[model samples]
Target: MRPFSKSLAVQIFVGTIQRLPQSARPSGIYKTRVNMPVYLNINGFEGDQQADLRVHGGPDKAVQLYPVAHYAALIKRFPELLGKLAPGAIGENISCPDLNEQEVHIGDLWQLGEALLQITQPRSPCSKIDEKLDCKGVAAYIAQSSKTGWYFRVLEPGMVTAENRLVLVESGNEHYRLCSILSLMQQNESAAIGALQRCLMAPGIADNLRLKIEQKIVHLNRASTGTP
Candidate 1:
């Protein structure tokens, strides 16, 4: 609308990463992830091999990143960024919760008026998040849930913020979104591959996304569809 509003005074940042006790990567059908530091960009993006996977909070494993009030008490530690970042950053977030508990669970899908994205997995605990928190055992709990991280694949890449309206814009078909296919991959390889293959068919989905989906698909078979 504003011919790309990167100049619209949009504010964004890297939030805290919750770490856990050291643990080995779990034995799983998909990728192997070890317990480590996982970072959050306040507006919901968590760092991952994929582009920023949007989420609701820190892994409910140990530290919860939502409920802004919890984070507000912690924000005091960052005085220089007091007003600049949102002296009330956490407060503003808790006042209006975005994705609900059930929606965050694996296999759930959501639609925000900003864009029609679908969450596929949880933000797995990474070593970087552990370093930021200076804590242990954080990553283990995350893997227990099968390293499921919250992911919001962009139906449309649009701007976001801590002060967003936080609304549910659409209710999705249980099968069409990525949530339905992700869990199935562990048990039903053919079906999972079929579903993921369809997702990669979307118009603007990136090459990275295509490759990740193809990799998961290839684990069952042997060939990749997209070239990284």
Candidate 2:
């Protein structure tokens, strides 16, 4: 067991839903940086709001985390987007330097400050983030690039701060890596069905994601059977 200690939660954040002048829809995508202490509950950060409950903020998808390094890489690729792509640009509840899809695995448990957290699944990026950055195709690019972040469920709700670290106490099922799962879904749904089913049965998978995989399985079944 290699030490899984890393600087997780480099920046804590929360946001309320607001209507942007450019878009007709309301979104909580614009997160505010939190320098002080905050509460992490079973649902999510106390002040954070999820505009679309259908897709986000459930018990299993309570905390969203993104890698700080990914933002820098994106900036290097698209220099024009330097300003728009900040710490909380993608509506993450935590901005971490090493808490990326490549490092973390589904069901990985950690001691995050006073709260116990578990990795659930890779984040499914939406078009709202693309619009937030005033850039088209960003969401698709994120999916294709496999830099989309991961989600965590709060097992032990408690107060946490930006200064806290995430010390991995145990590794989950190593068969499923966030990036690998996402890549499989994108490239071949048939190939991903088995993994998705396993994830659905896994203890740590988010409910929303389980529902999604179930729906995909149905669609694939119909496609294969030629059931129009």
Error of 1 at 142 (Å): 2.2
Badly placed stretches (over 4 Å) of model 2 are 1-9, 189-193, 218-228
Global lDDT of model 2: 0.79
Q: What TM-score do all the candidates reach, one by one?
A: 0.41, 0.87
Put down candidate 1 lDDT per residue, 1-228, tens digits, no spaces. 011111111122233323223443221111112133323332233432222234233222111223223233333543433443331232111122233223333222233324334443333445433332344443453344332333444444344444443344443443334334345444434556676766655443334445666778777555343334
The lDDT per prediction is 0.36, 0.79
**Which candidate comes out best when scored by TM-score?**
2
Give one digit per residue, the lDDT tens place, for model 2 in 1-228.
334545444788899998754676889888999878898899988899988888778898899888888888777766779888888988998888766787777788888778999888788789887778777778887778888898899999999877887778777665666766676566444666776677666668776667767887777767777888
lDDT of 1 at 195: 69
